[model samples]
Target: MFIVSLIFFVLFLPSVSVSYANTLFLHIEGKNDTLSIYAETGTQTKSYQVKRLQDIEALYPLLQRRQIDRNSFEQLLRELGIEVFEPIHTFIESSSEIGFVMAENLVKLPLDLLYVKEIPLFLQKPITYSFTKINSQNLQFSNTLSALIISDKTADPENGTYFLKKLLPSSAEYYDIKDINLTQLESIQTKDVILISAHGRIRFDNNDCIGLGDEQISPSHLARLSPKLVYLDSC
Candidate 1:
């Protein structure tokens, strides 16, 4: 896990091609009853160590429940000792985009979704997660480029695209599930951007798929496209 964390940090280091100001990369790993923290920026890098708490295994399951146990959740927060990890919190505040890589059971507990001191981390800034190494070359794009948003009636791509209109070029396109097919996504060019706000599910066999109302798009299908950006807003 530590090795994987190092590989992630190396991707955005100032020495890397994608290094940007106010960008923070954090990796949290828990193993052998200890929690390891690693954080880096364009100018600085820091590491910390803390003991893993008892019943930490239960925290993720509680979060997964439809009705969360507030008291238990808050107790988990207190047990995690966010205060003792003050340096990480302070670093996160100064960064714009956060790249979080969690190891083992830690991945089930979404750190960005948590509310610490009445402020959720995701609300504070743009937080992105990764399960594998991030390629810096594929991560850069023009914010003003035209976009293509695909969604179903349930998720409402209209409102979602409208909310993102400022970031997209005037020629941006919107397609409801009924209007497009999985094959169409392969024709996307490098100058285009794609956003899918639809239903998504991961099967036990590790086949990741997103619903298109009438069909599904899989990871293999997505790999064949070369878009400037592809945002998956579904669960």
Candidate 2:
């Protein structure tokens, strides 16, 4: 079984004068029975195929528990034909960056950090999609950037805050779980970035929920956020 989906955005770049012209690219994902690739470079378009892996839903929980075996996961990637889906490697060929969005379980085996046939995807190309797309509208002509990090060390001892600090600019601000809440989340305006490093789970109803500092937040709570970039590194 297979289904394909394609999404487009006309990103604008700012100079002394603003222009609407931009390049086109593709995004691909193989979730369960479907392997989808959407490509467009202004005029060209194509589709590719790969066999989907089984027991993906089962594997996700192992990932959440951090008990997944790399050898097995890589084998799954091989069956899924990461090499065949070359677009995954070159989607940001022009800009040399890739931005990723993943559910909490998938975060355990982050594709960007995996090895595809001996080549680490990170080494093949940079991942910048989040920074590029999220800030596309707000930071084109701005000089200032800010970040808010909400993490619960008790729930996640991975020290996501430490790693995020290393990834984000030194100018970015930091906040522990104790410093954030639903009220603050609703009112605080994250001008540049929002990173959540905590435990997450998918509800029976298919809603993605995150364990924040003082309270648990559901997808509905996050729907109102408008940060230029959001990195949910949990689940």
Top-lDDT candidate index: 1
List model 2 lDDT by residue over 179-230, tens digit each.
7778877786534656677766643346657776557877555545545556
Off by over 4 Å in 2: 1-24, 27-32, 40-45, 53-59, 82-95, 98-115, 120-123, 128-143, 154-173, 202-205
User: Which pairs clash (backbone N, Cα, C closer than 3 Å) in model 2?
Assistant: 98-127, 98-128, 98-129, 99-129
lDDT of 2: 0.50
Candidate lDDT (C-alpha), each: 0.59, 0.50
Candidate 1, backbone clash total: 0
Tens digits of per-residue lDDT for model 1, 91-121? 7767777777666456544565445455655
Poorly placed runs, candidate 1 (over 4 Å): 1-19, 29-35, 42-44, 49-87, 94-97, 101-109, 130-146, 162-171, 186-191, 202-205
